[model samples]
Target: MVTPELNGGDVGVGVGGGSFDFQRYLSARADAVNDALDRAMPRGFPERLCESMRYSVLAGGKRVRPVLALAACELVGGDAAAATPVACAVEMIHTMSLIHDDMPCMDDDALRRGRPSNHVAFGEFTALLAGDALHALAFEHVARGCGDHGVPADRTLRAVAELGSASGTGGVAAGQVADKESEGLPVSLAMLEYIHVHKTARLLEAAAVSGAIVGGGADAEVERVRRYARCVGLLFQVVDDVLDMTSTSEQLGKTAGKDVEADKATYPKLLGVDKAREYAADLLAMAEAELDGFDAERAAPLRHLARFIAYRQH
Candidate 1:
């Protein structure tokens, strides 16, 4: 498949022959997801913990994971309302990971979302608990919200399991461990791929696949969405690596060149910038091909999403 080039034109129009406005779609869905997230956790007792939780959760960034979940749900003919809980749950898990990942024991980064890292603002212990609280609350929200939204119990159970696996030892945690161990060590392409696939792609895959499962997608349909998400997930990391190499600190919000600075493994380090770009193009083509099995109009958002990730400047 010939993937569309990023020529400063609106690539969203390339999906399904120009019927969708991806910017508009992203803004609207992001607003809805933000509102739901705000309501999901409130200022309550233990003021500091709640405040820390709210701080990270409300911090603005691209709501990419949640958007993917909702879009996948819609593509499977599920009501967006029914998928709201899963969407919020994915964001909560993501936020929790960010909080922990930024702590003194981990990346030790002082900035997140262009603001103070959670541990820096709230102290290390409080940040730790806040992450734990959000992680627990994610499961709780899915359990209660799905039922409240009238999604079937079996589907809710499956969603809960998916979230668990993505957040736990089998997924993000595994990737993080491997990443830490690999630092300063000569990393082969396979090891780097393992780290990226587990740390980044697994949660994304779960997000998209869980949405399909919750939205009543057939087994085969769910598998296809999983494939699409896997391709997009790897593409996301590759783009991030490229941006790290090319963008400046002012442009990236966080410190750019951190990967090279830390001697960490990245696609650009292994494959060269041009080859990394070629790999990203290939991944985007594969992702788009997976969407071809679905209805074109319903699949437009996801199709455009692949291109957006590929071409986004920051």
Candidate 2:
């Protein structure tokens, strides 16, 4: 569904036309991202291993990270198509994290994106290996694609480092550790932010920052995009928590209410749904603020994206 602002009567951060066709935009971008991902990975020798990797990577997702990367690139006036390899790299890393996150040792979720979790379908050992392989491939693909596309070596190197940092501690790994520790324990709002910022926000921030860098944005522009992504990243998790509280498995395409069932802390569990929605609204405003100076037409997608995160019913 279209977000509140993009739909019409946009309470704040006015983009009042209600004509962006966001769903169409998302479908087109997702299709291109999926196709690029398909070409980026080929079935190779060690048949089962390749199969495991393909299983998770090909499994459908919202493609948020890759889209963020490409959009940030375009926002900086870079040819979004040239950013394809970096986009694919970000998605590969995200798939890697999901593989590990759903294992028996982690969230142990049986359903992901409407199918059996990777470990359930592929076996833990293979799933584990697949995660490792994808992680490695993310860096390799970034490096290879950067060289082929004639991106400046320095920029390419920075993007590579950025992805590594996002996947490592201080990013996804650190967030996962905090989340696991907080399970079944009382969690403060600050601690929750720490967890989500590190786990979810970090990778998303990296996605936009790296995209901006490779897209040839100035340092100031890249930093601004980072701030915008930080809000969107947290907004994503906040919305997820709300969805778990209100939506069904049929709507979400995955197991619903997993957070509460696990006794894990969530925004709704702490702040209640109304307050959580308020927080999401604040975040949406902040994200939109960061795009203020860019051309409205070029910036419309990012604006629509933030609203989508805020108002998405499904």
lDDT of 2 by residue, 1-314 (tens): 22323432243244634566666677788899999888888587888889889888988788888888888988899877767778898899999999899999999999888999899998999999999999999888888887677688899899999999998996999999999999999999999999999889889889889889999999999999999999999998898888898889998988898999999999989998888888888998899999997877777777777776677765
Q: Quote model 2's TM-score.
A: 0.94
**Model 2 stretches astray by more than 4 angstroms:** 1-19
Model 1: how far is 31 from its true place, Å? 0.6
**Winning model by TM-score:** 1
What TM-score, to 2 decimals, does candidate 1 have? 0.97
> CA lDDT, every prediction?
0.89, 0.85
Distance from true location, Cα of 56 in model 1, Å: 0.6
